[model samples]
Target chain A: MNVRIDTYQQAVSRILRFDRVQRTAHWANALLFGILMLTALLLYFPGLSGIVGRRALVVNIHVWTGIALPVPLLISLLGPWGARMRRDLRRVNKWTRDEIAWLWALGRRAPRVVDKFNPGQKLNSLFVGGSIVVMLATGIVLKWFQFFPVSWRMGATFVHDVLAFAIFVVVIGHIIFALAHPESMRSMVKGWVTEGWAARHAPAWLREETGEMEEDQSVAHSD
Target chain B: MTTTAKGAPDQKAGVTIAVGRRVFLGMTALGLAGIVFGARLESVLDSGLQRLFPWWPGFRIYSISGSYPMISEAEYRLEISGLVDRPRVFTLADLKAMPSTSFSQEFQCVTGWTVPNVEWEGVKLSDILDEAGVRQGATALSFESYDGADSESLTLYQAQLPDVIVAYRMLGAPVTTEHGGPVRLYVGPMFGYKSLKWLSAIRVVDQVIPGYWEQNGYPLNGWRDGSTGPTDLALTGGVA
Candidate 1:
């Protein structure tokens, strides 16, 4: 009754792959966004504007990175590559009978490991994506308004502050996970994974893409 | 303008070298374009969009029903009345003579943009009120701006959120005419509506009164963090 896109394994492998340009933009944006967030936090502390000295420079950097953040993000939205990445990122849940049994046995932790994205990552994507849009809008409004009334600006401040805080927390989690799972980080850095690493962490994806079952994998290993 | 500069090499030098020259020129042009665009954008960001679009209704403030300029310092007057033992009428000079308090905080607008950490300098409303002395039963104060767009009045509690102050200076400079110079109120923490410009009057009252925007169906309290809708009729109850 239901159609499945290439098995979960294929989707995972696709996501783990990135081109050199994609990786460069991804890391550049990550660094820039991190700096922008830090400057934003500095905005809260008095006298920081003096050291950064020019409010205009702070805003310039913030706006530039804001503009840049969307570039890599949008580029990742095309063709087969984008499609697979989207599938992996999607919150669509497809739990098989065995998976259901595993969930029943392991409680919350089982689904966390098997789920396409843990609830937190899904929430993080939504919040971060939403925050970027809001920040862009408010930043432009503040920057180019012929007559930005006071009330709207005030409201924007609260939203920006709150979202920035939320992003900070979520990004911390993302960093921790990337570091904790060195192999996961390695794939992103290297743009390719060996058969062994692929089989261990993404066996289902490996099997789906190669059309090899677990039994076939042992036969291949012996050969 | 010619593609080559005055001291630059002649195009006749060689085709291969000319191609390299053309590439260099192209890159320089792009770099120059980026710098120009970046600089323009920087200025645009520093001044805020309100400065760019004056005709937009949301960008301007209308007082007490939009009949006339909602705020005009020229027609403004500050009266210390109510339970005050000595009700005094202070001119702009009188208010300016008072000790001033200034600090920087984010200026938030409800429409969704913020001018971070604007330096605001003004005399504390409380300090002025204390000098005049609040008589018994003086539960609140009221503000009236030159803008008559508001159909109702704002109560003291609404006016005197801790972040509130009668501001006169911004960014360490006495406000210019364009920037609500002479004297204006800066309501901290709240959106720009709370900071009335061309502020000319302050009066002590015994009861909470809805402000101009409040009567116009804006939130009475107008707290920035409340529900994300324009529920202006809700009263913020507290004594300031």
Candidate 2:
């Protein structure tokens, strides 16, 4: 029984921070978002419009990209990776007192023991996910505005623009945070961080997976 | 353990049904509220928005030639020739003397802006076609603008569409030169590009002739029904 438990702990410890499926979905969504932003800039800015060669062409690409934004997410949800994502999402949604204290003491000290994703990361993901749905619905209405009354179209356009600006700000903040933490960036790119980095930054998560904590509490406490 | 497993599906099915019913009820309530609110607010709020933020207009001048030809009412004449039993030229006074029809229509642009409820007063193109005696085998009517650079054509059937007219007055007044004056053709159901301004001549033809914008990738039909056409694909270099 002891040998079997030791082997199971080793297997979990060897697992990468992000699996192949998750990384692929993340990159696909990133590419789609880039396409959406570029097309939107081309449409909204008249001075840059000449570079696109034709207005109708860019409009079609923009509409089609907006429609395809959710495809990667939906595809990811069909596999075991989806179940893992749901578990992570549940963890993020329910904040413990320790998390609140961590937020209050941020920059002054290291945060409390966090799981795979901290509260900030969870909030960012949720905002982006919700923004995608809002953008898709508003885009469809605008594209097929003839089917709807003028009032509805007006309302939809207003909402879509406001949400797009908000999402842009959130995305910038997310990128800055990723860049600030080289270990987190490496986990997303290489699908793993050094065991030392995981133990130091995500002690609870490492303990949950490996069923053991590092002996040096000072290392975990330091930012 | 076996009995508990068997009961699980039944409980899951019951939960699914309950959730589905709640979703249905919630959606129905939301939809009803939306319809009621939309109808009540559309007239007042839509107009208010238009007033505050008017980007495009009902009568935006877009002449192919930099300058629009200005013709006096006295000098203006609409010449009808080609594939007609009787070729004729009618002065503005003669066109006004014919039985007139008026209606409000939304002028839609191919670029996706619309000017709503524009009241146009004019005689039907069919009435003028009738007067000129369009000969058998004539499939289309080509329109020339006094502006010299722009022209449009419609099939004989298109010309006969009930609302298509040679509009002389706009909003209960004489159409100014700035807005396709002494006379202009209004292809009511088609995009604004098809409605050639500065009306000069109409010629009956044996085949469909592509208009100015139509030659440059705007749709030939351009009907407001949102039907996909060659131009819609052509704009994307036929990729879509």
The best candidate by DockQ is 2
Q: After superposition on all CA atoms, how large is the RMSD of candidate 2? A: 12.2
For model 2, residues B160-206, the per-residue Cα lDDT tens digits are 88789999998778987766798999988777878888999999998
Alpha-carbon local distance difference test for all models: 0.53, 0.69
Global local distance difference test of model 2: 0.69
User: How much does each candidate deviate from the true structure in C-alpha RMSD?
Assistant: 21.7, 12.2
What are the interface RMSDs of all the models? 22.7, 11.1
For candidate 2, the docking band is: incorrect
Model 1: CA > 4 A from native: A1-22, A79-107, A112-123, A145-149, A194-200, A212-223, B1-240
Candidate 2 Cα deviation (angstroms), residue A161: 1.8
Give the least accurate 10-residue stretch of model 1 chain A, judged by summed lDDT. A89-98
Runs of candidate 2 with Cα error greater than 4 angstroms are A1-15, A97-113, A212-223, B1-240
Least lDDT summed over 10 consecutive residues: which range in candidate 1 chain B? B1-10
Give the per-residue lDDT digits (tens) of candidate 1, residues B83-165. 68778887666767898787888665554435556798878877777778877887766676554332234455554455577
